[model samples]
Target: MRQWNFRYEDGEWLASTVPPADDNLTAAVETLVVPFGENLQAVESYLESWGRMERENGFNYSLSTPGAVARRVSKESVEICDLYDQFEDTRIPEAEFISLLRALSTAMRRGT
Candidate 1:
């Protein structure tokens, strides 16, 4: 399975399983557009909780298409699900997902 990762480069956010050496989303299998301002605050809150909304409920962020979402599937996993069958879902460990988001958030803040 491909290992998922995220980054912010040239003022755009990227999500992919590409290696850090690539540094671009050209090969990304999935992408999520995250806007600025209040959305950043929401991201911060999400980061603080690691997308855990409640005891049984977690987080679900839409992808580029309808029904496609990055969902918190378990205490240790986050899955990018394509509900319309356009593509296969991808899963990443929660710890790694949080780390990727944290780094991307910092990079976004630094304008890097």
Candidate 2:
């Protein structure tokens, strides 16, 4: 199974399958950084916006800086694709994704 966890390290919160070894931004199957302050709120808002029926049904959510795009594959799953590198793409359950975000938010608060 894909391991999902988050940690507060070096003034940033990192959510990844495995915590990165160093600050060099090593490759991982899936990862996202939850920056402190207002950015954290933005991340939470993005999470909350998922799985909504009001919007267009097949819309893709793009994370520009990370070069990743996400789309809901089903009610329970989401697919993430790396625009720069196809090897990093993955599909995971929406619940797991939300859990990761929630953990990152909690970690950010604790780290602050």
Candidate 3:
């Protein structure tokens, strides 16, 4: 259910930032851990677990910065230092910002 790019010419699954030049995309995913998910998870987990109260407790991670709202993203799959971007606020493409509170609330309040 996830989309990714990779090269399989050699005996190993070579990782690269370059996209394929052909149209013969294959159904091969080198890793199940999603790239987007890594960013989201990093920010979400930090907000949910620890933060100075006002620093978003998972449900809300909106930090008013100089120009835009920045969020702390953390993930094991990615190098913690390189996972976050300063001006990477929720811009352009519309994507849902989910929180652990919302997910847990729904689960716990189900059938009530």
Candidate 4:
């Protein structure tokens, strides 16, 4: 399973899949970062793009933002609640959620 984390720092939103090893870790090994000022617009654009791409590719997944975690559910409406229960202490943000979708889209396009 792939896990992601996001943080707003130095006027930018940084995203990564690697979890911090300890409380002392400051900088994250980011996969991508969009300037903080562009967050709202970027998120909107990415969501629309993802929707169109999914339609064109006949993808059947749906994204759900409930509380802190972002969930990916299939047409059947199944979720990984069991997995989420394991990490009840963690809190994720909407930006990281959208970033995860973007990452998935990119990976799919690359056929990886």
N/CA/C clash count, model 1 = 0
User: What TM-score fits each model?
Assistant: 0.54, 0.61, 0.18, 0.35
How many steric overlaps are in each model, in order?
0, 0, 4, 0
User: What TM-score should be assigned to candidate 2?
Assistant: 0.61
Candidate topping TM-score:
2
Q: Write the per-residue lDDT of candidate 4 for residues 1-112, one digit (tens) a residue.
A: 3354455556544545665433211122122223223345455565785567557645344333332222334332222222223333322343544556566445434433
Task: Pick out the ten consecutive residues of candidate 2 with the lowest summed lDDT.
Answer: 21-30
Better of 1 and 2 by TM-score: 2
Q: Report clash pairs, candidate 2.
A: none
- The regions of model 1 sitting more than 4 angstroms off are 1-11, 15-30, 33-39, 49-68, 83-87
Give lDDT for model 1: 0.52
Instruction: Return the top candidate by lDDT.
Output: 2
lDDT of 3 by residue, 1-112 (tens): 1122333333333323233312211111112112212243533553444346334453333333122233434321111111233212222111111222233223223421
Q: Write the residue-wise lDDT of candidate 2 on 1-112 in tens digits.
A: 3445566566555455653332222232233442233366766676666635315555444432253556566666766656655346667676766666576666556654
Off by over 4 Å in 3: 1-50, 54-56, 71-112
Q: What is the C-alpha lDDT of each candidate?
A: 0.52, 0.52, 0.27, 0.40
RMSD of each: 5.5, 5.1, 13.6, 12.6
- Best-to-worst order by TM-score is 2, 1, 4, 3
lDDT of 1 by residue, 48-75 (tens): 5543453435444432323345567666
**Residue 11 lDDT in candidate 1:** 56
Clashing pairs in 4: none
